[model samples]
Every structure is written in structure tokens, then in C-alpha cells.
Target: YSSGPPPLLALRLFCGAGDSENLLLGGARARVSRRPKAMASAHPSQGLPSGMDPSMVDEYASQSKLLQEFVKIPSIGKAWVFTSKDENASRAMVSVSQSDLLANKKRSFLLNTHISKSSSKSVSFQWSPFPVEMSGVSAVVPSPSGKKLLLVRNAEDDDSPTKLEIWGPCQLENEIHVARSVHGSLYADGWFEGISWNQEETLIAYVAEEPPQPKPEFNDSGYKKEGSSQKDFRSWKGQGDIEDSWGETYSNKRIPALFVANISSGEVRALKGIPRSLSAGQVIWAPSSSYSLVFVAWSDDNGFQETPRKLGIKYCYNRPCALYAAADPFKEEADKPSTDSNKGDTAALVKLTADLSSAFFPRFSPDGKYLVFISAKSAVDSGAHNATNSMHKIDWPTDGKLEGSLSVSDVVPTVMSPQDGCFPGMYCSGLLRFPWLSDGRTMILSSAWGSKEVILSINVAR
Candidate 1:
């Protein structure tokens, strides 16, 4: 049991003009206040309506207490199922969260479960005795081998720095604190979040906020000299440029950029060659020896007008985006100072889907033979905010060579209308990181079927 102050139970009472009462229970007092006539008329009764039965208030309180108990039950947030070396056994890690109403925060924890399959085609799960609480953690990612765990704790304020902790089986292995000058908090939101570990697990590539832009500096003399680091109480910085954001939930958030961190040396570097007009997200390590990166880039010119305008992109799948590939920044730096004349072109970003208007959520096959992605071309071509989705795959070069253009093949075409009791269409929100089954050609994903959601096993080879 946790050792701290006992949980606080609060009860608020609002009375009419001439009604008042005092309640004391469990060494705590209830707050009671009177409402004015105008407010009483506008907001109605705080306990019961004018004509409603007073006994109903007691019933409501009883139901509210039941809801509080229900709220205490944690909800599953994420789950990962791993196959064990033993043929019939497996392990699963599930992240669960509960709302702390007293503290106005969310308490998250991880639970471990062991699964075993029997010859009778039955399955059973054995849960651990206690859960491990993850306090103040923004994200937790495990390496491919499950030997290393990465925990991300984002800064809560401007003065604080983001912290990354790497934990081994027994103890904490490494802790890295990133200053604000390097980059802002990493994007934990699933939309722009893309944290991936390479095959070797020595490096990690993810999406985060770009470094803050330079602001206009001024002093008592008016307009401080350029590149001057003079420090004085009179000198202040002004907002240099007012840039438009993706709108809605993205307010005050910086443009999402690509970054890579060397877990061994604790060095982080932003990926180069991406254009300023595009924002990157959902990055993944390409199946190449050089460790190339593939990501989705959204253009800023997504407005209805001719000029560039930043539109709300949270759930609007119609936003024009395309998948692009770029060489690893570290590899580029290592190969610099070479006499190759085509270095510029080789280091530049290459568009993987030049023909499709919308492509995202790129996933490589288990064998790295094909790169499959979801397309919202119907939504982009039409003016709809969302529409039926289609699945497509590109034959990745076996030699890890990227060309100017690659042929795209459609696995699942968008179905506008369906017959009675037939397959409607694919309305997918997102895909699991590893959606493939034992067979390398089949993929399992969830899609919307009318008002209900159902899982489908699609064979990309078809």
C-alpha cells in the first residue's frame, strides 16, 4: 500500500437564496453556498430540480458513488504480445491507466502476463502479483530483443529539461538530459509520434519539435546588434515571426521535425535534407544497410486557397501527405568531404509515392521485401474530411538501392458501395507496429465495419 496522506473526499452543496446547511463527516467539512435568483434560474437546482422528487437526489448520489468505484478500475492503454523461445509459451506487457480525481492526474502502470497454448487449442493467462507503477513517464519503448527499455520524461516547464532513461533488466543503465536548445519535448501523441529502434538497437530515430527559432533582440539603445551575446536587464527578446500551426490541438506546438539519438554516446542530431515546407512524422528505419529513414511529410499548402495555409490536421485524413526516404544523418556526416559529384542528389530526400496524393503509416514486411502503406486518396481527391481507405505496397529493392520512381501495387481498393451483407470498405484509423502473422504475406488490422469495428487478415500478395 502507498504511504501518504489519506485520500480526500469532497462534497459540494449549492442552495437557493434562503437555504443553508452545515455537514461534517470523516474529519472534513462540506462546502455550502447560496445561489442568486438570476443564477438559480439560469443554472437550475444544484441538488434537485424544482418539481423533481427530493428522494431522487439520494438515488443520484448512490449512482455517483458506484461510478466512482467503476472509475477506480484501470483501463488498458497499450499492449504488446511477444513470442517466447518456447514454442507454446508467450509473454505480454500491458500498460494501464486510472484517473486520480483527487490529484487531477493520471496514474499509469505496467502489468505482466504469461500465456500458454495447449494441444486442445485452449489458452490461459497468468498475471503477476503486483504492477509496476510508471510515474511521470511520457512514453515507454522496449527494444526489439526486450532486453532494454527506454523511458521518456518530458519537461513540464520551460526551465526544465527533457530526460531519457535507459533501463536494463536489473537497474538503470543510462540517463540523458536534453536541453531545450537541442529540441523541445518529443511528440508523444500518436499522430505525430514515431519512435523506432533500428535492428542493432544502438540508435533510435523519432519525431520531435524543432529547435526554437531566433527571436528579435532589443535593448535600451533600440535593436541590439546582430549576433551580440550582451546580457543586461534592459535587453529583451521579441517574437520574431508569427507562424501558423496545424490548428486545433496543435496550438502553440512547434513544427514536428525528425531527430535521431545515439543511445550509446548520448548524442542527438536532427535529420537533414527535409524541406522547410514539409513536416515529418511516423518515421521508421528502412531495411537498408546504411540505416536509411522513411517518414511521412505533410505539406503546408493544405488550405483551400491558392496560397499556403496551415489547416487542422488532427483527424482530417484529407491532408495531402507523402512518404519520403532520406539517408541517415550520421552516415551522411561520416561520408562528407568525399569527391563524389552526385553527393548532393544522393543526400536529398526522395519521394516514394510520387503518384499517390496521400500515403502514410508505412510498414515494412517482416522479411523486408515490400513496403506497405495506407492511402487516403479518395479523401484527398475529393473534398471529404475522411473516406474509405485503400492499402498499397511497393516492391522494395532487394539490394537496398533507391530509385527515382517505384511501381505501386494496390492490395485493397476502396469500395464506395457494397452489396447486402458484403464487405463494405476499409476505414482504418491506425495499424499496429507489427501487424504481420506467421506467414510473411498476411497482415492483421482492425477496420470499421458500419458502426462496429472488426479485425481483418489481409494478404498483401493478393
Candidate 2:
């Protein structure tokens, strides 16, 4: 439930930067003057008056009166927005999937919109002439600089190879073909999908099914040892040992691994030393530093035993996971000792969130002042598949030194249930890998306000 101090209180009662007025919503323009006393006199509850239409106001009045009176942004499906750290340009890449029952076919289209910063306090969006057809795309990711986009086409058949395409704004830059033996199909499901582009935009980090294990060979006479490579029709192969994956969502397959690919050279490197008992996913490139990879590793409950058993991870936030920072396999050698290891080990994996039970969706601020993340501790503790979440931030050291005892400041606390006419609670399906506005302190995210998913803007600085 949206809780505490009202979700949109900051916008309705507080004033943002600048003295000039601008249109905050579509088809409506509310003048926000510097004169606060006069503005407050009009609405006792809201210091800022609504600039939206009455129909929109009535639609949202029950959920949040203050939000209805302030701003109205349409609900979006799958979307990606990127803004340069210099704050010079911003763009949004949005997609919507549609299926036709009569035709029995499904398709998706991508719309590109340019976010214009009219002023410090004003913003607007202008859509392109037409949307580009994304016919066979399994996943779409934009680079940090917004100069390049990565599109993945997963293999529909077991014999076909997976395809990766790198595209610029107007042209296809490069393509890479990955065989099934190198790595199985890439995970596009939200929970297991882990794709990221490095700061320099030279490499990409992602998660995919690990290489298949070698099977035994057979001969016409009987079971053949490793030395025989003759085809036999009489002998049948035995079943191999089964590997366990997370219960609900990952039952069909197992073994999610971390990999890095050099876009320019077309070379892929598999990260080693990560124990087989722990499945890795949701990886991202850290800020400019020696330890460039940060990912979430989920350990099996029976890690000590030979047959490692995985705990349920799908939609269940209760499973314990910590953010791990490690050296990039491609940039650094495997034998090199990790310089930032607090745990006495030659392996490059360094645990960052040792104190938290569950942590995911890591985002470094534009200025790299802090690392912000979301925690589902309540869901884990209560044994619920999904529950309210809390937002937290760790003050990043300017000198690029990080310790285990870094103090974590709470940005948004968990709210179970709220009173009537208030925010229900935070329903963050998942935070965008990079969910930040032009200002470092302000962030825009989507969450379930009641039955409808709504967008929320929160200022961690405040």
C-alpha cells in the first residue's frame, strides 16, 4: 500500500526548483508561481493547485486526491528511458505486445520518444513519426550513453543458434551468433534476465544457461567408455544426474551463469570460481573501477552437501541473496588476486550487501554519489511470494573505496496496509535497472497503487 506522509504530498504541498511556470501535464497547464501563500489559500490541503482536467481528477480522487490535483501520466507497459549524465539529452524506448486471436499471431512495436527539458522546472515529450516494428525480438536494451541498442533474438528450435544485434539510432551496427553449445538460450524472463552494457559501451554482461554437461557414450556390444566414439543403435543412454533449480519459475531448467562479451572483438568470456551451488543472474556493470561486475547470487540450501538443493526464488523474495561485486572476466585475468577482497580469498567475488537478507535492482546515481536498491525483507520474513518493499541507499565513497560497514540510509520504508484514502503500499514489480530523472535526487518508478499500476516520483535527498 502507498503509505507514510501521502505518496504525492511532496508535489502537491512542496515547490520544486525555479520560479518560472510550465505545463506539467497534457491538455492542462497549471501555473505554479513562487508566491506560496496565495497558492495555499486556494486549497487548504494542497499548496499547489491541479493542472489536470476534472474527468482525470475524478478518476484519481479516490486513490489519491493530491495526485489527481497535481499531475497525470498515462499508465505504460514495458518501457525504457535513458538520460545522459550531462543532462543534455533524454530519450524513452517503449514497447507494447499485441496478439490477434483471429490471426493467431503475436507482434510487438517500439515507439521512440524524445524527452525535452524546456527548463529546470519544466519537461515535455515529443513522439517520433511512427513506431518501429520489433517482430522477432526477445529482449531490447539500450546502452548507458543512449548511442547504441542491443536486441536479442532467442532460438525457437533446439538446433538453431541464438542471434544478437547491436543497432544505432538509424542503422544496424553489428551482429553476433551464439551456438547452443557455448551457452543455451538467453534468459529473457524478468526474474532471470540479466543484461547490461559497460560504461565504455565496449562490452555487455548477461545471464544465460550454462553449457550442457557431457554425456556418456555407448557401443553396439554394451556400455562404452570415453575412448569409444562409434555410433551404436543397440545401446541406449542412461539418464544423467538431475540438477535442481529454483522451485516455481525455474523448474523447467537449471544453471544460470554470468558471461561477458566484447562487442568490438566478438569474444565471449565465462566468469569462473562462482560455486556451482549458487546460481547467478541479474548482473550489471559497476561504476568505473577495478571491480566492474555486480550480480545477485542465490545459494542452494544444501550447499554443503553434494546434491545442492535450491530454495524457491520465483516471485518469492524470502530466499536470501546478496549483491556481489567482482572483477570483469574479460578485462582482468582469472589468476589476478582481487585487491578489494575483505574475505580472505583469491576469488574476485566480493559480497557487498552482507547485512541485508534480500536485495536486488541496484542503481548507481548519476553523479555516483550513492548506490540505491530495493529490499523485500518483509516478503521474505512473512513467507509471502510478494510483499511491500523498502528503498535504501548507501553513501558512496568519493575515493572509490568501499567497506562492509557502509551505512545504509532508508529512503522509503515498508508499508503493509494503509488507512482509507491513502496510498495502498509500494508494489514495485521490479525497479528499472536505471530509474533516475535529470536530477540525481529525484526518481520515477511504477508501482501498484491499488488495482491500477501508477507512476511515483520520490526524492531520496529529502
- Of the candidates shown, which would achieve the greatest TM-score relative to the real structure? 1
Q: What TM-score, over all chains together, does every model reach?
A: 0.86, 0.72
Off by over 4 Å in 2: 1-76, 81-91, 114-129, 220-223, 247-249, 302-308, 334-346, 399-405, 415-425, 449-454
**Residue 16 lDDT in model 2?**
53
lDDT of 1 by residue, 325-379 (tens): 8888777777877777556444678899999989999999989989999999899
lDDT at position 393, candidate 2: 83
Candidate 2 achieves a global lDDT of: 0.74
The residue-by-residue lDDT of candidate 2 on 1-462, one tens digit each, is: 233343234454454556745534466767765566557466533532454433344445566655544333333457777765647568888886555445666667788888878567587889999877788889988887779999999888779887889988789888888888888778888987899998889999999988777666555666678666666677677657777767676776658988888888777777876887777888987776677887888777622221246766666676666777777886676444677443323455777778877778788888877778888878766666678888888777776555457777888888876889797777787777767776878888899887888999989776
TM-score of 2: 0.72
Candidate lDDT (C-alpha), each: 0.85, 0.74
> Which ten-residue region of model 2 has the weakest summed lDDT?
1-10
Q: lDDT value for candidate 1?
A: 0.85
